[model samples]
Target: MFSPFDSILAFKTAIYFFLRSLLKGFLRRATGLCELQRLCYANNIGAKRTKGVEKSILLSRCPVLKRINTQLDALAEADELANNWSTVEEAVEATMVAKQINKSIHEAFIQPYRICLVQIYGYRQLIVRLDQIRGIAFDHNNEVHLVLLKNLWKLLCPDTELEGMISKQWTDIGFQGQDPSTDFRGMGLLSLENLVFFATVYTDHARNILSHSLHPIHGYPFAAVGINITHMALSLIKAGYLKTHLYNVESRIYTVEDFHKIYSYLFASFDKLWIRSKPNSVMEFSHIRDKFEAAVVKKLQFEDAVFRWDPYLETI
Candidate 1:
């Protein structure tokens, strides 16, 4: 067993194994490079070349990286999963998933990056669109935005006497100065829209929270914090971090409602967070906001994360 011939053979076998391993790894890297090239060329000749099962797999998975591929496979079955066109909430809908199978396989199955590219484009466009709206300089002459602002004020201050847009009554809801317009400089009409949507759609919850904002000892500026939260959500979406919450939905599924839902989640959750933090005064808002954002980020890291608002107090 200890013969020179046996020892020489063992050494040779070990060397051969190491060389084969290196060769295999090199081949794998080469194959991955080719795949990346195909992905880059996905809209062109690569689309025509990829066919049948391979094509389907590539469409569903996109093969961007090994890790993502593995994660997608484990998270969902390809056939059961909805195509990118379906909304995130709709994708998980059983009826929609069934209908998806009826659509042409060719159309239903396309590279996810195409969807991502569209959403990224749309996101930039939305930013520009909102920015333009913001640039409109809060015309007191305009009936639409001003009317909406008045409606929001009226809804919150039903019993109070009306004093128009310049009233100190505006401060009760958290506007920075006499004019609510000044506070909306950063978010424009978008902030106002979010506030109106929150108050109108969730009237009871909004009223309850407004009362909380008037808490004798501990309170933050309700409308001001709402706008800041909108900025926080926009930052998350722009950075592509919202992808976690929208994972089950299609990549192209950005909407104003989506943003509003985030606002609601932030509003409701921040209330709970604020109460729990038990700050001695409103001056601690920055610290609490940072902590709240950190918590939201933690939740977004989960694969199954969904933005939700669970209002603890009943509508007043």
Candidate 2:
């Protein structure tokens, strides 16, 4: 498995980074600015600046800089959401002090660097909140869960009345069985929340996508596929594959609402792709889903990728 060419390429890459680090250190000494300050002052605002700041923090050897992220993680684990900004401000001050940079002279670097820190750490906080929600299994007996489930049905099927809680009519909306509770095992309440958000916020688009799922020949399980899309979105976020897109799209702090928007986009895009593929049957879902996911991942690899829902595309 270890070819000579592969070994040589790896060695070259390592040396390149080592030399680059040395150059950066020399430049910092000459310019009297830390790597983060230099990046903030040099790069344009938005994704490019944010991404550079993230990489700088990840690669920094300074103990204070390194502990900044660790402290943020600890705060998130303790559910200290209110103190995230204060913590970030403290870290920025500590970083300035550690590098012995006078904030009075380089006031411009403060806001840009702070904004990037907010985006970076805010993303981590969002992941923690999402994980907490995803861990909650669907409970049929819970009043709030029952209300959400019923609300989903009413939003999708306004005229149809439920025969009972376990009626076969549940399949009309694409639940695999009369009782939809069993389907929420993997993603838990997150799946339901995504579906409700899509239906309630983007009612027309949601209905249109649902109609496509009812296609006689190419019909797929709407609810199940939506849950799968939720899982895909979460996986990408956790893997840092969504950083570029989120950094570009979300100027403010990231939230569950942003995650839901991503899910809606994926679900709509999947529907469009599925129709274009003209599959022989629903059995081909796995193949088509893999191809769609690969395409999405490729798109997200770029520094400026921002996914948006195209309502007009539904007609195409």
Candidate 3:
């Protein structure tokens, strides 16, 4: 016969996992899980809650919780009954834990730079730098203007023909080199995304390299939403730019996932920013395109005139 103490202990333990599972699952979804596997997605986010909340989570799992994670482990153990038994218990025990831990196994191995946390300084200076970059890069004439801005417009303002604004801007700016689109695209010299990207890089590098002497963009609510390096890199690729600068050699492991995040954020999330402007079918909205291009050019022109564009550097 089972002793009363042993039976009581098992009952309490079961009740504990049961309530813990329910609370974790419910709480995680409410916090923006997008989608969660209901059967076994108590994202291991470590939490400290009262036992009463814990017990309720456990009591509801009579037929469900204990067996939820067993089959996968059991199948892999095929015929090794001894191993399968141990695996099943381990799986069940793990389910009692949450997915989002205060500390994670990856903690020991990965050192992630939460991109959102970094500080950006000096907007006027950043604008000056962007302008310097622009004066050199875009000061050329070609159908290339039409192409580069068109692609960027498609991303920044889809469903519109930005060719006119591109033409007007190039002419007004007195473009002098090879049109950036035809000469430096695909091979990665001066794509539109390059502006936002290299600005971050050069500014940071300049600040680091030169210490406080270098000025950074200030007072612009510049921010990156998530630690999605993959998304950033793909943004580079999708915008027809190069993926050279997103990471060091150590980050090669998470590169694919990072790219996916970049693709999702650009094409899927802020992509709508591309088409968010009010449409003026009757009135040529090309001027709005001009304003946007000018904003970009303004950013470029506002910076130091020294950072001239040389399409050749893109290839090298």
Candidate 4:
């Protein structure tokens, strides 16, 4: 049961919302604030009375702003007879002001401490591309549910920097809010281990969308490797640890050291990550990891040299 205060606040919220809608739609009216105050009073929401417990009874009798305007036409016309006249401008101003106030009231009723959800999605591409591969492909719009994943990616990575990296990479792939289970409640979202998952799971459409999501600009065939290495690097950075790795291109492995010198001025930020898959991301990482497990593995070790030696890596 809501208190009278709650009812008034809800009414205020609705009125203000209507105002915002009117503004967006460029709609106008011929009403004013006192009329709104009257509407509240008539709905048993104002200074005089209180004691409505039935939602159906209480809400059914309440007048909507639109209806109120229609009902007040005769009274407003009478007012025009008494005064000079009026236009829709007064009504619009009243509604808009009410809307802003209602927004404030609504905000006041909300709980503090806004929360952020970190959602992670599994392999869709690897699943689609390899029709033979077996794995889960989340197809539902709201399939993934995440309250918090990995402490908002806290560690060596600055909160903001980690946030940027997460947003740039995984955040966009995430599908949140869907309950994954058939049960009454609970979201269906889950994560697959990077490259392996990508190579073995994901629907064809999921695969395409996942690829596009990762590299909306340039489709890095090796994006998976880059993602894994980046996550590994960020993890290490958070733990005050480090790693060394390589960058891959077209099945060729080049030491980060080589590119460090060539793109030293540019790829310096990734100095800690080793840029080796030498593919780019999880998909690339999956392939490179299998083909070159003998060579790559966890060789991408990091140390103080990762940042002290290369400034850009520190930003990542």
| Clashes per model (N, Cα, C within 3 A) | 1, 0, 38, 41
lDDT digits (tens) for residues 1-316 of candidate 3? 8899999999998887777777767865786331122221332111111112222333444343335324432342242333334443443344334333233432321112111000001111222233333344433454664454444334432344545543533322112222434333332322344423322333332122222111132111011111122234333333422222222111222222333233333322221222354343313234443444344333333212111222224211
Cα-based lDDT at residue 12, candidate 3 = 95
Residue 274 deviation, candidate 4, in Å?
A: 11
> Taking the tens digit of each residue's C-alpha lDDT, what string does model 1 give over 66-161?
333343333233322224334323322322233232224333333433343334333444444445544555668899988889888877777887
lDDT of 4 by residue, 10-107 (tens): 99989976775565344224432232232333442211111111111123323433443442343333333113223233433344354443534434
Worst 10 contiguous positions by lDDT, candidate 2? 307-316
Best-fitting candidate, measured by TM-score?
2
Steric clash pairs (candidate 2): none
Question: Candidate 4: where are CA atoms >4 Å away?
Answer: 1-147, 150-213, 217-285, 291-316
Q: Per-residue lDDT for 53 in model 2? A: 92
lDDT of 2 by residue, 177-293 (tens): 989888889999999999999999888888888899999998998998998999999999999888888888776678899999889888988998998998889999999999999
Which stretches of model 3 miss by more than 4 angstroms?
1-136, 166-191, 195-316
> Would you give me the overall lDDT of model 4?
0.29
